[model samples]
Structures are given as C-alpha cells and as structure tokens.
Target chain A: MTDTALHTNSRSPGVIVLRWGLFLILGLFALFYLMPLFVMLTTSLKSLEEIRTGSLVALPREVTFEAWRTAWSGACTGIQCEGLRPYFWNSVILAIPAVAISTILGAMNGYVIAQWKFKGANFVFSLLLFGCFIPFQVVLLPMARMLGLLGIAGTIPGLIFVHVIYGLGFTTLFFRNYYVTIPAELVKAAKVDGAGFFRIFWSIFLPLSLPIIVVTIIWQFTQIWNDFLFGVSFSQAGTQPVTVALNNIVNSTTGVKEYNVDMAAAIIAALPTLLVYVVAGKYFIRGLTAGSVKG
Target chain B: MAPILDIKNLYKSYGTVEILKDINVAIEPGDFLVLVGPSGCGKSTLLNCIAGLEPITSGSIAIGGKDMTHVSPKDRDIAMVFQSYALYPTMSVAKNITFGMKVRGVDQETQDRKLKEVAHQLQITDYLNRRPGQLSGGQRQRVAMGRALVRDPKLFLFDEPLSNLDAKLRVEMRAEIKKLHHNLGATMVYVTHDQIEAMTLATKIVVLKGGIVQQIGSPSEIYNRPANLFVADFMGSPAMNLIPAKTKRNGTGMLIEIERAGGEIITLHDHHTESLPENVIIGVRPEDIAEAGFRAGEDVQEAECLVDMVEHAGADTYVVSHLGGRNVTARLHAETSAHPGEALKLAFDLSKVSYFAPDTGERLN
Candidate 1:
C-alpha cells in the first residue's frame, strides 16, 4: 500500500498534489481518535488552581505530576484513599483468567463445531448467535442467583467463570468462523493417524488458529477488564474489579469534583487494552481478515 | 503373494440415496489397485468405506484374513493419504511425521530412524523444522505422504493424492508413487479420476459408473476388451466411434455393410462370425482409422468420407469426417497430406474392430 499523501516536497508536480490530497484525509481521521486522549492527558497534568482559573483547552498555568500521584496513591475510592492501584490489581486478577479460559474454550468449541460432528452441533452454534443478540442485563439476575447458589458468589472465581460463560458465545462464534475456513482434511488426517479429540485440537487446529486466539484474547480482555455490571453484581466490595472501583471514584456525587484526577484514573484504567491495540494493531486487522473475509 | 484384502458386496447409502453399490474387489499383498471413474461415481466413497472412515450398509471388509467391517479407522491398521494433504499446520514437518508413532507409544529410537528415512525419501529434510503453512503445495504433499509412510500399516489408501498438483508435478509424483510401490511391495488401493493415472499406476483397474462397477481388469484388457459399450466409450480419449451396420454371417465370419453420406457404401471384413446378430453396431477407435485416397472404385473395405476439420498434434493429424451421416475421426500419419473440404477413403483397422448388440449395448462375439 502506497502512502498516498497531498503535495509534498517532491520533484513530480501533479503526483505530489494527488498524494497530498489523500494524506490530508488520512491525517484528519487519525487526529479524530487521538484528540480526546490528548485533551485528557493534558488535563491530568494541570494543577487544580490552573484547572479552575484557566479554560479546559488552555495550557496549564503550572505544570505538576501531583494529579497522577494523587490518583495512584492518595485519592479516595469509597472511604479508601489507596486511589486506583488496588483496583488496577483487582482488575488484573479478574481479567487474566477470564480471558484465558474463554479464549481456550472458544477455540476448542469453534473447532469442534466447525470440523467434528456429533448431534446438536447446530443447536450449539445457534445458541452462540442467540447469546450475541441478547443484552447482558437480561441475564444478570439469573446469573447472580446461580453464582450465589454455587457459594463462590462475590469471589474472583465467580467473576471469571461468569465472564467465560458470557464470553463463550461470541468467542466461540469468532473461532468457529475462523476454524471453519481451515481445511477439515487436516483434522481428519490427524484422526486417521489415531489422534483423539484433544490431541488433534492441541496439535493441529489450535496451533493453526493462533491469529484468531490473539484476536479473541485481546477482544475479551478489553471486554472483561472494563466490564462494570458483571464485576459489581457478581463480586462483593473487596473483589470488585477496576471498572467498578474507577466508577466509585469518578462518579462520586459528594466530593468536590477533581476533573484532573478523574481523567488520570480513566486513562489508567484504559491503558492496558489501549496499549495492546497499539502494539498488535496490524495483527488485529490481519486476524479479522483471516477469519471473516477468507471464510 | 496371496490375496491380503477382500471387499465382499460392499454397499453404502446416505439416507435414501445409494452412494456405493456392491463394490467388490480382492488384492494380493503387493498388488496396486486403482478405483477410477468420472466425478460422483462413488470411487472415493468406496475407498472411504474400506478405510472405515465411513460405514457400509451391507457386505464385509477383510484385511489379512481378519474381518474389519465395523472396525474404527485406527484399529484397521491402515494408513491413508487424504486429497487435501492435511498436514498438522501447528507441528513441524518432523513432528507431523512422528505424530502417529508418538500415539502408538513407539520407542523414540525406532521413531527417529523411521522419521528420518521417510523424510529423506520425500526430500523434506531441510524443511523438517517448518510448519505446513510455510511450505509450498508440492512440499506439503510430500509431508502428507511421509506421515502415512512412517506408520508402516498393513494396508495403504490414497484418495486422489495428486489431484491438487499441477499437470507436470502430477506426472512426476505418479512415477514416484509407482517406484515407491516397487520398493516397498505393499498392498495399496488408490483412487483417482484421471484415466492416465489409473492406467499407469494400477495392477488392476476398476472402472465404475453410477455407483456400480462397470469393469475390473488390467489396463490392456480394459482398452482391448471392454465389457460393454459404456466401458468402451468411457475408457478411451475422444471415445470410440460407433456406426449402425447390417450384419450377415457366412461360415465362421460375419459381414457388416455400412452406407455413406452420398449413397456410397462399404462392406467390412467379418472377423468374428460365431453367433453374430443381424443388427450390429461397429465400433472403431480414432487411432485405428487411416486416411487413404480413393482408388477410383473398391467395393470391399474402404470408407469414403468428407473431411470436416483437421487437428494436428505434432506426431499425427486427426481428420474428423462425415460418414454414414455420423462423424468419424481418422488418425493420419504426419506425412499424409490432407486438408478440410476434401474427400478421401479412410480405412479402419480390421484387427481392432468390435461389434455390439444394437438393443443391449453388450459386446457381440
């Protein structure tokens, strides 16, 4: 892909003009997504006095790192002033296991639904698309009761299991479409060689399905990591994920508004997924193309 | 070697439709058998049934004198090469070759030796560390072959293993497979739709149509003595030409009289007079017909034809002509000067002519 840009300092006159035209459009779109993050970062660096005195877009009257230090260490999160660090740790514990289990089961389920057949595999698949449509709130009460009966309610395991269950439908669907595009004969060759179900999966399908796994891991990590409803509903106060803790700090009505610290906390909460996107950006598009377009 | 595999009245069906009907064959320990037919002829289905990848609705399959009708694919002790060259995409070429050995709990020493030998034969030693996705089509095909070769099972099955290759590669692999068979002397059943592959690879060729066996014989037998009209037409390139001719038996021979387009006629020499029918159809191969200029007048054994088209194929020229209100193709020597919109007398190869019953399509002795 040539990077078409509007007029640049090139010897060719008309070609540079056309190139510059395309670059002008592309640069505008890039700035569209980056502007908000820029504003938030700049606001997080402003002192409280500068924030009250100067406009939001104005440069900080006094530069300081106090807002970040306060957000990380001292700002109160529901009567606790440990700021967002503990909540960030809490989110890590919940997100990692949930993402791992969902991605693994999703790959296996997708592979089996696509390649192997037993009865009701179609039913299993239709149930996935079915879950994709229904909003998460519809299942919240029933899931809460189910977790309470299991006696692990308000625990990390409970939250992780809930994410896996809810995430299974979409993740499996993503994986099924991905694996279905793969040649079924590869799986059959393994079976004729006396490989059982899990053996063929681990050795053949799962390995070839790495791209989709990356996509699945990234998608579910963002979804589970930032999920507020399930984290707060299924978990007690101590086990609440970072999203819930962040919500308590930023949405508090009683305290005087500290927009600088609030913006910093929000950025901190979003950093893991945003960093992942930036690093694996090329892979994300490649994986989607491999899964959907080819299929 | 005595016969090691036998299929007796094997039948398969999907719901209400029959896919394979009464497929029966027997092969010796070192015999190479080929199942061949047009697409949807159920040749692949029959091989799948034998490998126990599919169930047979009737009949039994036996290997090494043991019944394996309901056996699973693994328990049958058979190795199969799928058409798609289904290599494990995640495993290295080395791991793919050793996978079967690993599952069977083979000692690592023996596993290493067999893997090395098969890989060397397939010429994939340099790529032993790469995954299947990283290899070319021909290279992946070799790995698939190695996966099966490493197993050393009692029977080997190949399902159109070269169909995915280019024409040149297909020919190369065809010769390689034949050479491999010579070295191993293993019992193998291979399926392919290519007529040339069937002719070159099989010790016995089974031609199938509409899910039924049309003929089963050696390559020469299939070409020279087809069992019926369908078998005769299906096996040959450009197909055999058939003409309606009147038959008359005298002594030990029969005469066939054919009428040409412009009311000119010719009488064929009667070769087989034993039990000849009055209404007979004469069959001749295009290669058997030769272009000869008319000799003014000859009532005995020459066909006058108007040349319609000329197809030059380097070694010989094929002239398609209109004779007896039907198209007849004649093969001419490269030196034989003939052109379109001309008339000539084409002589049929007397020794190669065959007769068939008009109504039944069966060979008439």
Candidate 2:
C-alpha cells in the first residue's frame, strides 16, 4: 500500500460533547457582536412616545417611516428647518475624494518606504509611526496653522489635507509591514528583468498587495468619513462635512431631542462604510490574517 | 572554451562578521560549476555577490573579459533562479516569464515566441495562464526556471534550486537541469549542499567551509583528493572513516600506526615527504574495506571486528563493526552473511588511504 492512505478516528463521547459545547459558546458570542445594531434599527422605527413607555428590547407595535422621512428631508435647527438630505450628499462628496486620494498617497508612501532604502528613510518611517500614536487634538492646532499659511484654511481642501496626512501614518504602517513580509527576492527578480522602481511597484508589488490595500481603504474610509473633530475644526460652517451637520442636529441645546430622527440620521451617516464592510467583510478578515501571520 | 566569467579575490562581510574571504573562481562557457558546501559556508553569499545583489567588499568580477565590478544586476545580463522559486504570486506563468521582455519594451510577437520556446521546453505550456499560487510546487519551480530562461542572458545562477523538492522529484529535476544545461550549452553556476547533486551535475565542484574554499576540481578529483580533513568529512555520506593514529620514525621514512578500538595496531602506507607528527589521522572510504579472514599476506592488512549490525539494500550491504573502541563502517557487495556479535576479518587497501595532521585537521599529502 502507498503511504498516502487516509485513516479515521473512532468517535468518543467526551470529544462529541466538547465539540457541541464549543459551538454553543461561539453562537452566544456572535449574538453579543450583533445585538446593539439590532436594537438601534428596531428603535429607529418606533414613535418617541412608544420608545419612552416601552422596554428597550420590545418590538414596536406601531411602525413608522416618519423618523426616516424627517431625518432625510425635514429638520429644525434653531427655527430654520432642513432635512439631512442635503447633508447626506455633502458627506459622500467629501468622503469619496478624501478616501481615494488618501488611500493612493498612503499606498505610494507604503510602497516607497517599505521597498526602497535611502538615507534617513527609517527616520521618516519612525516619524510617521510616531504620528500614529499621538492624540488627534494634539495635531489640530499645528494643522490649522499649516493650513492657514497655505491659504486653504476653513475649506474642504483643508479638511481633506488633514485627513490624508493623519490617515497616512496608520495606512503606511499597515502597508509597510505587509510589504516587508513579501519576499524581497521578487523585487530583485523584477529589477533584474529591467524593471524600474515605479514599474516594479505597478507591475509586481501593487497587484500582490491587494489584500493590504483593501484593508487600508476600509480602515481609512471609516476614519475619515466619520471624523467629527477635523470636520468641525478645519471646515467652515458653510462648507463643513455632513458630520458637522449631524453633530449640530444631535447636540442642539434648549431644543426638543428627536431621538428617532437622530437615530435614522446616525445610520445614514454610517451607511457607506458599513455597507462597504458588509460587501467585503471576508477580505478584511483575510487582509488582517495574511498581514499578521508572516509578521 | 575560454573562461566566460572570472572572480578575483572576492570578499564580503555583514557588519562586523566576515561571510566570505578571498573567494576566487573562473567559469568556462557552457560549463556547469557547482558550489557545494554546508549552510553559511558562503556559497549563497558568493552567488549573490556574483549576481550584484550584495556588494563585494573588495574584488573584481568580470564577464566576457569586461569589468562588471560596479554593474547593476540588470546591466550584468545574468538570470537567477532563487531557492524559494520566488514567482510573483499574482502573475500567470506566461506573464511572469514575459515580464522582463515587457519591461525592456520588446514587442509582443518576440515576447510570445520566446515565451513559447521556454514554456514548451519546461513542459509548462498548459499552465501558462494560471497564477503561481494555483500551481503545484514543481510547477512553480518550472515557471521560475522558465522565467529565467526567457532572458537568454550571458550566464545563469541557481541558488540551491532543487533543495525544496521531495526526494523523488529532486532526483528527477536534477536530471532535467543537467539535460537543460547540456542542450543550451549555457554557462551556469549552481549552489547546493547535496553531494550527489554536486557529483552528478558539476563539470567542476568547489567545496567550501567557514567562508573559505577547501577545494575546487572535477568531481572525481575532489572525491579522490580532498584538500583537508573538513573536505574529506563533508564530501561523503556514511562519511569517510577517520582513524586517529600515531607517527613514528622508522628507518629512513616515517610510518603511521593507528590504534584500533580493540587495542590492535595497524600501519598505513606513508605517501608524503612531511614527517608524520605524533598524532596523525587516516581517512578511508567505506567501500575500500572488504573481507580478508585475517590473512597472511604482504599487501593485505587485517583487523578482527565484531559485526554490530548489517543493513542489506538490494545491491550492497552496509556492515557496522567496532574496531579499537571506534565504530567503523564497511560497504560490501550484496552477498554478505555476517551476523551480529560474530567475529569477522576486515581488510583495507593501503593505496586508498588519506593522512592528516590531527592537531590542525590539514591533509598531510
């Protein structure tokens, strides 16, 4: 007989019980991750009166689209009312450019600093890494001043630049470590074949680096798209990201809090990145594990 | 053929530690040179230095009679097959093989023609459209070679290219590489730790140790005349039996007297002008010993031994026996009937022996 024969293990009661118990515990933990979003979705469809009188977990007796409708097109802000419809479009416009440009720059920076070695390159890498560990407030003043000097203060460009700069630290860290694990010989192989640095990055490194790129895009989109601090600080009141509008709507003082509209608007603001994760959740997990295992 | 490549007084170091010292070699056109050594003996480092992946500390490397000391690896016109078969995982076999041509702006038709020639030769035409991750290990390795072959460069460097294969596949691929070298008449330098690979593929073999070349010669020459004790030990499997002996001045010549495990004295024929030191060593290949029944003869030397065990492998029997408290092995023809713990007489042929200074481990010849 050949050495490649398959063998089966005899079943044991203790093993069977342990397997079932493992699945049960895992099922319970899965519910923990999902319960909060479930509660929020159900609550957004309930009337304010019903939400106040009813238990948090109970299904609404009267389902209404009033909250979603009000959140979308009708909202009062200190006597003037306009729905989040205008703000929703504004958020997407701000986010798409910010995410794309930031990711591209991040990918380039990751590729360069990871693959090439020049003098003081590690110092540059260390500074970028140092940027990652600092608090957001710490950079707000210097960034504001830098933008002020550049003639882009209190504009979308100002906020866009800040997002890209801050996002680079983490994105480069991710792509740098991931590319470091890639066999250096592949780069040498391409180089030996007459490929230049940019050509190597485009033809060889970029294609194989998809998993990490996907990961960086997912992570940076969420960070920049939902950012309220820079959105409030860098952008003017007229040109603010939708986050500025959402914060204004939710935190208005001496006004009646419309919890349902607030909930619906919150989901609207989060929908793009959340939907992205839903579509490419498997890739996120793959990217994380692939980057980690070699490390 | 004249030499296609020359490396003069090569040196390499990593920070404070020197990895290669004064490595010098010459490769003839269409010649296959195998750099055989243990790991960290600088074989791979030498190959890397030749490929321009690592900078030499001080030396001259010339290809085709032109100095390429500072040439970029790409400008050197050499192709390398890495040990890991470093295929771009995202690229298909055809794309990986044509990547070099594409980068050099060679037109599509020429690229496709060259690609077809290599693919057909390596038997990977059917898998040309598949990415490296989708292929088997052997297939990936073939693509790696195909990637190198498409360039048709001045020289080829292989860094332990077959070390990752299973035993059966290794033998098959070793033969394939030998055939490939023959068909192309390409100058090649191969690195390997496998002695069999060195013996089978090399027109010249360079054995190395601790960043130094111990010997460089044809396989028969290296096998018959290793330059040092380390080379002698490293060159053979079921390694050469190293018998420690004493040297004494006898008449006008020096004599070597070895003490066997059972307190028996055995003399080896001296073949050198250097006076044998008090401590000398004799190295003999296992197959050089045979049965002589403690005979009474001038040329035959005998030692009585108890057979430890016998391993019969179809065509030969490997008999492990004890001599003067040392384990000595004898490879004999297949019909041996010696049993364990039984007394037997083993004979040594004097002409096949190698002598060394036991203190320095240097060969006396």
Which parts of model 1 have CA positions greater than 4 angstroms off?
A: A1-22, A25-29, A253-255, A292-295, B120-137, B249-252, B274-278, B291-300, B358-360
- Poorly placed runs, candidate 2 (over 4 Å): A1-70, A73-82, A112-114, A117-126, A253-260, A292-295, B249-254, B270-275, B293-300, B323-325
Model 1 Cα shift for residue B183 (angstroms) = 2.4
Highest DockQ against the true fold, candidate? 2
lDDT of 2 by residue, A1-295 (tens): 3333322233467777898999999999998987877777888899989888898888889999899888778865434367677766766777778788877877778788877866778999999999899999998899889999999998777777888888888988888888878888888788788888899889888887878888888998889888889888887656767777777777762556678788888888788888989987899999988966852
CA lDDT of each prediction against the hidden true structure: 0.84, 0.83
Give the Cα error of residue A100 in candidate 2, in Å: 2.3
lDDT by residue (A1-295, candidate 1, tens digit) is 1344433334387877788998999999999988898789889999877888888777677788888988887778777888889878988988999999998888888888998876889997998879888899999999989988998899999999899998999899999989888887776677679888888887777767767888888899889988999988887878888888888888763556998998888888899999889988788888888866752
Highest-lDDT candidate: 1
- Chain B TM-score against the true chain B, candidate 1: 0.93
lDDT of each residue in B125-182, candidate 2, tens digit only: 9989999888987998899999999999989999999988999999999999999999
Per-residue lDDT of model 1, residues B257-348, tens digit only: 88777655777766546567788778888877876552222322566677888888888888888765578777778776677888867877
My TM-score estimates for the predictions, one after another, are 0.91, 0.88
Candidate 2, pairs of clashing residues: A73-A83, B260-B324, B261-B323, B261-B324, B261-B325, B262-B324
Report the error of model 1 at residue A154, Å.
2.8
